[model samples]
Target: MDVPEALYLPDGDGFTATALTIGPWDAAHQHAGPPAALLLRAAEQASGIDGGQTVRLAYDILGPVPVGPVQVRTSVLRPGRRVELVEAALSAGNDRPLMRLSAWRMRSRGDAAPATPLTHPAPAGPEESRPERAAFFTTEVAYHRALEWRFAAGTFNGPGPAIAWTRPECALVAGETMTPLQHLLVMTDAASGISATLDWTRATFANVDLSVALHRPPRGEWLGMDAATVHGGTGAAQCNALLFDADGPIGRSSQSLFVEPR
Candidate 1:
């Protein structure tokens, strides 16, 4: 069998997180991004589409998903002709839940209506951009190595707002065509990293959940995020992003963050 360059290796029963999927802390744990995208893969399968596009995805990171063998199960919670809601759960063993997700797939109403209020302009293309190789390029995790990043505005692993163009350099699951939805979902988690508000040394912020809403299926392979992070005095932070395709604005994403002193 051919090797996968992306996040997971597909097995007979389920999939396993590779070295690329390692989290910020340890090699044994996976970053929320790749695992969340994997949940979308399962959700898309269970959605039964009937005809709609996946418009929204919400993921709750139940606990640390140990890096290695993991099983994902997706089911339709609410089924409809015009709309469908599907959910996916990731478990490693003993039925212990690691992550849960809910996705909404909605079909076009065939109404002659204008789409988004405004389409955000995409930044410069990735060709004119630079790869992120900062001092914070600490480890060579599978997820970091698996993606090709091009920064247009801000710097990654820094304290500032950022606009970046991103593309998955590898496959999500072996042999499975990485769908546009899967591509977009994975990038949403990186929004926080692209636009960080706190010092990584003094404080650590890990997202507890990710939520994304798309107006339409993105066109082209490259995706972009005009991302920002806001910290509250109370111990919480929010990462919000305006999502765009190579063409124009498609949707938005948000992450709830848990902040702590490192």
Candidate 2:
């Protein structure tokens, strides 16, 4: 079989990370986006989630995930017909879990009223946006090459809020089709970096956890984020982003950051 030009390749029971999974911070470690998407895929496939839709996905970063073979373990934490909680963890070799995902799934009610229409207007579409490269990256990186980025407002080199749209050029896994949730998860982790308020050379702002809440599922291949980071006086910060698709607003994502001088 031909090699897959994707973020990950399926191995035995787990998947092996490709160079596309590398993040801007470290070439040896995988970006949170790829792993987050992987965990969500596992959670969705786990038993007891067949009839339900995942409304919330929260991830805790235990450590830096190395770019190599990793395994995912998933199980239903709380089982129910209408509501359920599922957990998935990613680990490499004999080391402890690098990341853990807790997802809440809810079954849809046919007789329930329709969802409230979103009034929030979307940012400029991808066609109207300009192509931009992240200034923090000094050398060629696989993660950067794996996705197409366009800016509607602000910039990757600027310090402030930003509105950007992105889509993966490659699949998440070798032979599997990426779902809409998986596509959204793959880009949500970059909200902090895309809207950095601090200089990248002066200090480092790393997210410890990521929480995403979706009122409705996203559609289409492209996803947009109106993102901003707020740094406190203490060694803490938060990155908030409103997620959107080609249609309109779909959800929101937040990240709790750990700030420190480099």
Candidate 3:
């Protein structure tokens, strides 16, 4: 409805912390916190139990994470009964690791059977669609204004490779409610920078790594992102995604872009 009050906090059993502040669209020189669902809310506040139900989520970008004071160290690593596994690490002091995660917290068992009817290719409804605020990418336009995007073709002006269809005007927190896997990692990396090239003046990218995988968690919240940008020249690039939640295709995310040339 109107959420955004979990800047990450909770350090104890297993661990859960977030202060290495850096959000004006993040990418603090590269990337630190506040995205990827604030490291899944510091792994659901070290899995203290709240909106329970994730199934599986993993992340590893052990490279660029520097801004100031940050810590997240969760641990459960499998306590199956209804399935539970947690392992997080986002240190920023020791300067050794940057990000590492492992999730699979669950406790849902209510499927009556008789469910099979889904479709895809429906992403242009944000009142019609008007996403192109190119102002030299002001932090990717304030992180795409927190979602509700539309660009089912390719035209962010430059970089190359794009296909959009996001949704998240706000709705993802666990301690209360709403958990479509935290908006599927917040729009699954929002259509990685240009798939090929359309001349947005040139191109520019920076995203060391990212990974996501879910397959039967979402059922609502109109989620569906079929991204691309499979490869880029020299500088370095790679993006791939396939996540839908309209009752079909549950998840898949990948990123490793780092292009440059503007």
lDDT of each: 0.81, 0.87, 0.57
lDDT of 2 by residue, 1-262 (tens): 2333888999999999998888877789888999999999999899484656889999999999999999999989999888999999999997489999999999866688887787554458899998987767644655666678999999888889899888877889988777778989888999999889888888888899999999888889888889999888899999999999998898899999998988
What C-alpha lDDT, on a 0 to 100 scale, does residue 149 get in candidate 2?
92
Tell me the alpha-carbon RMSD of every candidate: 2.4, 2.2, 15.5
Candidate 1: clashing pairs of residues = 19-142, 20-142, 20-143
**Candidate no. 1 TM-score:** 0.92
- Which parts of model 1 are misplaced by more than 4 Å? 1-4, 109-112, 134-138
List the candidates ranked by TM-score, beginning with the highest: 2, 1, 3
Two-way lDDT contest, 1 vs 2, winner = 2
Tens-digit per-residue lDDT, 202-240, candidate 3: 655656667776646776765666666754457776778
Best by lDDT: 2
Best by TM-score: 2
Output the lDDT of residue 42, model 2.
Answer: 91
* lDDT at 5, model 1: 75
* Native RMSD of candidate 2 (Å): 2.2
Between candidates 1 and 2, the TM-score winner = 2
